[model samples]
Target: MPVDHYTYRVTWSPEDNEHVGLCAEFPSLSWLARSPDAALKGIRSLVAQTVADLRENNEPVPEPLAEKRYSGEFRVRIPPEQHRALAMQAAEQGVSLNRLVSMKLAA
Candidate 1:
């Protein structure tokens, strides 16, 4: 798989005095370099090598998080008092609680 297909991020680390590259699908792996681009390149090479190693060992490689599907819906638990307040507010607006929450999230 192409390294671009994976979720990668580069961030500066004050402690290390360099940029660090991280791959979401391979949390345990990291690459540090003086520049962000180099860090990213290093991590990408590492990921490709790791995937190849896994394949050779007959081990399962994790799918890239960027390729995963997400449902638009998810559940969140809230205190009863907070729930009641939201419900009352939704009622005053002539909308369901779910609709109100969805609108707030979109904002």
Candidate 2:
């Protein structure tokens, strides 16, 4: 079987300590690395894992030949106190607020 591939333009933005952050058009998928090339390589790894997961779970894989891009937006609301707590916890854990939220939601 041939594995279909989708191309994504990943941007590397500098973070603290000379590390760079990888950002894709898809918000759920990003990574941080010590170098720009490493960040882009990390993006490929992440995308590959996502594809594998979709296949393993028998989820419908979007036909990249047709749907070259996918985008969506939604709003999430939380109590102000709870939001502040999460932010503090994320900072303590040395991760982004978005990452902390993602892990919590995934669980």
Candidate 3:
């Protein structure tokens, strides 16, 4: 039940006028503070509390994104015109469409 590996991020929140911390595993939970460090700590503390509560209640806990396995393959749909454009670009670059898309995405 370790939560340290859970994906965490801190960013400025325009609406709240403060830094906000977010956890990927628990999207519904967040912490707002005046500083990024405080925001991060607050979210981590909140997550620990939430995890303890969940375990106490016998509720299922979410798997951390870092602990999940990915196959490196997923399908994405785009407009036919965009598809054709990418295909043409891939051909011109002497690469497969998948490779072209992967390079673009990586960039």
User: What is the Å distance of residue 2 in model 2 from its true position?
Assistant: 6.9
Clashing pairs in 3: none
The regions of model 2 sitting more than 4 angstroms off are 1-4, 14-25, 65-107
lDDT of 3: 0.96
Q: Can you give the TM-score per candidate against the true fold?
A: 0.82, 0.44, 0.87
Candidate achieving higher TM-score, 1 or 3:
3
**lDDT (Cα, tens digit) per residue for candidate 1, span 1-107:** 66679999999999999999999999999999999999999999999999999999999999887787988789999999999999999999999999999999999
User: Which candidate, 1 or 3, would have the higher lDDT against the true structure?
Assistant: 3
Give the lowest summed-lDDT range of ten residues in model 3: 1-10
CA shift at 98, candidate 3, in angstroms?
A: 0.7
Residue ranges of candidate 3 with Cα displaced over 4 Å: none
Task: Please provide the root mean square deviation of candidate 2 (C-alpha atoms, Å).
Answer: 13.1
| Candidate 1 TM-score to native | 0.82
- lDDT of all the models against the reference? 0.94, 0.67, 0.96
For candidate 2, lDDT tens digit of each residue in 9-96?
A: 5454545544443334335776677776776777767767777788999987555444454453346999999999999999999999
- Rank by TM-score (best first): 3, 1, 2
Off by over 4 Å in 1: none
lDDT per residue (tens digit) for residues 13-102 in model 3: 999999999999999999999999999999999999999999999999899999999999999989999999999999999999999999
